[model samples]
Target: MKNFLVHSLLLAVLLTNSCGSSKINKTSNPAVPAAQENVSNQAIVPAADQLKAYLPLLKGKKVGLMGNQTSVVGPNNEHLVDVLLREKVDLKFGFAPEHGFRGDIERGEKVSNDVDAKTGLPLFTLYGGNAKQDSIVKSIDVMIFDLQDVGARFYTYITSLHRVMELCAKHNKELIVLDRPNPCGDQVDGPVRKDDKFKSNVSFHKIAMVHGLTVGELAKMINGEKWLENGKECKLTVVPVQNYTHSSIYKLPVIPSPSLPNHLSVRLYAALCLFEGTDISVGRGTDWPFQVVGYTNPVYGDFTFTPGEKAGMVKHVEGKGAVNYGLDLRNINPDEFKFTLKYVLYFYDKMPDKSKFFARPEFFDKLAGTDELRKQILAGKTEKEIRESWQPELAAYKQMRKKYLLYPDFE
Candidate 1:
């Protein structure tokens, strides 16, 4: 089954890659065609386009940058650090986010501090042991953040930004955010975290699961809305993208991280991430993480699905080939479809070998933000019933988010 799925994915990739070159322009609002037309006329450039704007401010000051592989100059594809080094912009040090400076590590993997091979400067790992802002920001006059975010609350990179921003505010250091497009764009979804809820490293802000703001806009919202620690705001400057529309999704020239190779993976991550706390292997070791999930259970053969006339038959036995299966669910509406813990619990309950499924109570609770979801799942509640329990909170969150929205709404 693994081989079959791989072959199917390869076929899809080959077919999609055959299309001719086309420019991916940044879009604003897809709901209103007139608004999209208005945004397109301005012809917004990427954050890298405004490199010259920072040169004057950066001169004679110790500068620190928080960026990864995706931080590059538009059109030329030059690394931002290398460009700054050539222009002699007083680049003091480098800071890496989730996947380190090279963007090679897997999700939740720890990165260690190291020297960059190309620039030979100290690269500090903000995603590992010593991730505190004071540990990496003491000697720098200003800190610039420019990492690509997948626009999901669960994604750790944005939390890193929030932590650094708080520290910058505490120390009174200037913080500049080189904005990029939110891959998910302006379509917000899911419940917002409450003030009394656990707001740890994974969730730093009180926004929805899919907050519809760019990093720059987020900075502004944080400051303007007073969402920071003790109601203190950072001295922030957002280098806004020119002509960027909320509806556009850019095909990044450089891969941001190993797991997120393409937009398809990003799209699927929102739903599949729920399985992270479960024993299911969401294709981490394979080429397509989040695209395929399999387990070593023996009953996989019991659930057989035919793929393309005589393409292959997936057997029910677990472990490798016997348990391999793929899902083609582009037709599902992400916003309307309700997801709850029961989806996972029901599968685990029905599996013949329940011991094969590992359930870490703490880990699952952190991922879902409460043990109630897990407890109810374990108690055999259906997905619909579980979703109904959270409806009131989700509805209240939706109303609260309206005041913070930056784009105009059609509905």
Candidate 2:
């Protein structure tokens, strides 16, 4: 206890000392359009930032946080784990998803189950489909999910959220989802997941790839739709962000994943991630990561980038020790990106070697949540045809999604 207090104090000092001369320009209300957003404005306050509203519920209860480095609070940008410790909230064990507790681990790298070095708290690994264990869920009275989601189906954090929600429902544990903004909340593009097949860790729910809902709203849908075990809903409580709406443009204070290091990358992730199913390198080894898509071929896009073994990019896709040339999309404004299939279609049409383009067909199908897309792409269907194919399903999904929304939607 003494050691934990000392560590907390040290963290407090470290965070306090980080008070820079530059003011934190948080948006006061994000109900306006993105083009109107300014440096002088204050954005919507996240639910985690308003601790007083929900911290009382955790008093005298064993707490378990299912979070990562993205789980932060306030204008100062302090870690939620540290804040809880300071508040004397009894945080029992922290459950880490894909990137691990502190989010230092690489993407899909199996984070080892161990104790947190700073707080001395036992941190369990929930990746690789391991959090469903009965032993872990029963240990906590309240399971707090406070991670930032990029609002993509393949992102994997929401998959963890789905599985954790299921476990919480079955175990009868109080699931508190401290809601954060969906950076891609405004746009609802791409196809929705089919009912049968292609369901995996990435395709947790049947929503569209770029599902425009906060974690809280999604949680409500999971319960409302009776998506849990035997149609049982989890005891869920959503701490919603203040002054946030579906149209509100949320700039992530921290990168949600290792590959997505900035707003541009996060914006491009929904569409560019499709490149993963192909032989293309989505700037994995570069600083841009998801912002650029490149390969060593004349038929590909004019822009080019060579992969390298760098931090956050421990392994570059298909570019091991070799330079892969492709497009560099950094110069383009992220807001201009609609996350449509135009880029993917264009690349597929240009590549001379059609068979060699998609190395992992199954993985691509998994990401898209349907083999129909691949079939359409292979058949040389136009982007309009493919997007039109998604209309019925996407429309149904949007209608269903409206039922569970916690705030103003992107209507």
TM-score of each: 0.75, 0.88
Judged by TM-score, which candidate is best? 2
The local distance difference test score of each candidate is: 0.58, 0.73
RMSD of each: 10.0, 7.9
Worst 10 residues of 2 by lDDT: 11-20
For model 1, the superposed segments whose C-alpha errors exceed 4 Å read 1-37, 41-44, 129-136, 195-197, 298-350, 353-358, 379-385, 399-411
lDDT of 2 by residue, 1-95 (tens): 22222222111100000000111112212333243323233568888888887899899999888887777777656777788998999998777
281 Cα displacement, candidate 1 (Å): 1.4
Residue 365 of model 1: what lDDT?
58
291 Cα displacement, candidate 2 (Å)? 1.3
Over the full model, what C-alpha lDDT does candidate 1 score relative to the true structure? 0.58
Tell me how far the alpha carbon of residue 212 in candidate 2 is from the true structure, in angstroms, after superposition: 0.6
C-alpha positional error of residue 284 in candidate 2 after TM-score superposition, expressed in Å: 0.5
